[model samples]
Target: MRINILQHTPNEGPGSLLEWAQANGHQTFVYHPYHFGYLPTAEETDMLFILGGPMNPNTDLPWIKKERQLIQELLDKDAPMLGVCYGAQQIAKTLGCQISEAPAKEVGWAPVYRKSKIVPGLPEKLLVLHWHEDMFEIPKHADLLFSSNDVRNQGFIMNHRIVGLQFHLEPQADNVREMVVNDFPYIENSVLNQSAADILKTPVPEENKKTMFKILNYITGD
Candidate 1:
């Protein structure tokens, strides 16, 4: 399978998702639309994974608009896609859902409760890494999958193929460190946020990788 990733920043690459693809022998390609201003068409994408970023979907940028158009094109085909954080917000906005500031910025390891059994075997509550100030409203006809105390729309699943997660489950240890180092300012002076040292020192749980792989498998019809 051809797994195409839309990465927004150098620091935020496809961490465990790349790992999963490699272990499964799937071909992977990544596009940096924020930097390169190019995106894959729906015909070229067997599966699409949109990674997180600091920018919101509503940003008045040409590449943002193009990316949203690509998202809509892929959705029209019911392509297998997974959007993370800002990527999720982009998907929500394209689906005619609202994007607003979260009650509080979530930038650390936080617990998200599973609200639906769309992806079976997820624990009732799972600790996942988060780093975003904006949140997306669940799209119409989409099933809410997870929720955190600070963010109600942690995840959503639509058509059993498209998935949107507002947290970071694909980050490995180095990926987390890079995010902490590059985006440190977002966590400062926030009660809901965790310290950089704490966020980095804590080991990436084994279950996090397993759950990510599980979601990948589920989305791709493995």
Candidate 2:
């Protein structure tokens, strides 16, 4: 399969998603829209994976607008998609949903509980990587998959082919480091946000990695 990845920033990447794609013998391509400001059509790719970023998906940027168009094209075809943080917000915006500021910034290993069994292997409650102050509403006709105390609409599934996760389940140790090094300004010693020292001290949960693979398998029907 040809998997096309849209990486919004240099620090935030595909993380464990790259491992799963390579392990499954799937060809992967990455597009850095922030650097190049380009988005390819969905016709050439078998699947689309959108990674996280600090920018708002509803911003009046040309690339963001193009990205939304590409998402719509993919949705029309019911193409398989996995969208993280910013990616999830893009999906919601494309589906005519509201994207607003979260109650609080959730930046650390926070608890995300499964709300539906739409996809298996997700634990009832587990700490997942989170780094965002924006929240997206669950799209119409989409099933809510997971919820966090800080963000009610954490994860959702649309048409079974598309999945949106507000948390970063694909973060490996190095991936987390890259995020911390580049986006350290968001980290704070608040009740919800964790300090940089604490975030770096804790390791990425093994179950989160397992859940990422499960999500990939479920979306691809592998």
Candidate 3:
């Protein structure tokens, strides 16, 4: 599989997703719009793995709007795509849904229960990394995937090939710890309800690869 990661921040790169791609003999490319400006074509990637970011999708930035159009075009192709955090918000915006304030910021390690048929070899609930103040409404055509007390629309699947997750199943313990140490300046302590240590303290196994990979596999099955 070939995966293209749309990275937003220097801190939140494609953690587990990149690892899976490498381990499974897949090629990977990353786009850092924070430094690279608007991208050229969404058609460049076989599978799109949009990573998390601190920027809200509703911001009046031209890049945000341009990315929205690009995402719409990608969705039109009906290819396998996964959007996380701000990426998910962009996906929701492309689908004509609301991307506004969540009930509250969901920081730290949170639990998300699975609810859709798309999930492959799924469990009841899983501990996923999370750090976002914004959330998206479930698109009219999307099925509910997972949720917590603060947010109902934690994840959604727009079509058979596209998936959007507000949580960060792509990051594990060591990466979370790295973010806490390296990206501490970016986090808003007032909004981020949990401390960095507390977030990293959450349970996440080194072999917790199947859940996210299951979503990817279902979309890109043989």
Write down the lDDT of every candidate, Cα atoms only. Answer: 0.89, 0.89, 0.78
After superposition on all C-alphas, the RMSD of every candidate to the true structure, in Å, is 1.0, 1.1, 2.1
Question: How would you encode candidate 3's per-residue C-alpha lDDT over 1-222 as one tens digit per residue?
Answer: 567778888778787788778877889978777688857486776788888887988889888888888787877877688999999888888888988888877777667777776666777787777787789989888899888766888998866788889988887666787777886654565244667666666677543566887877777773
lDDT of candidate 2 over 91-139, digit per residue (tens): 8999999999988788888899999998876789988888888989999
Clashes of 2: 0
In model 1, the clashing pairs are none
Give candidate 3's whole-model lDDT. Answer: 0.78
C-alpha lDDT (0 to 100) for residue 134 of candidate 1: 87
Off by over 4 Å in 1: none
Q: Which scores greater on TM-score, model 2 or model 3? A: 2
Can you write out model 1's per-residue Cα lDDT over 39-90, one digit (the tens) per residue? 8988898888989988988889999998888899999888889999999999
- Ten-residue segment with the worst summed lDDT in candidate 2? 185-194
Total clashes in model 3, counting residue pairs 3 or more apart in sequence or in different chains: 0
Pairs that collide, model 3: none
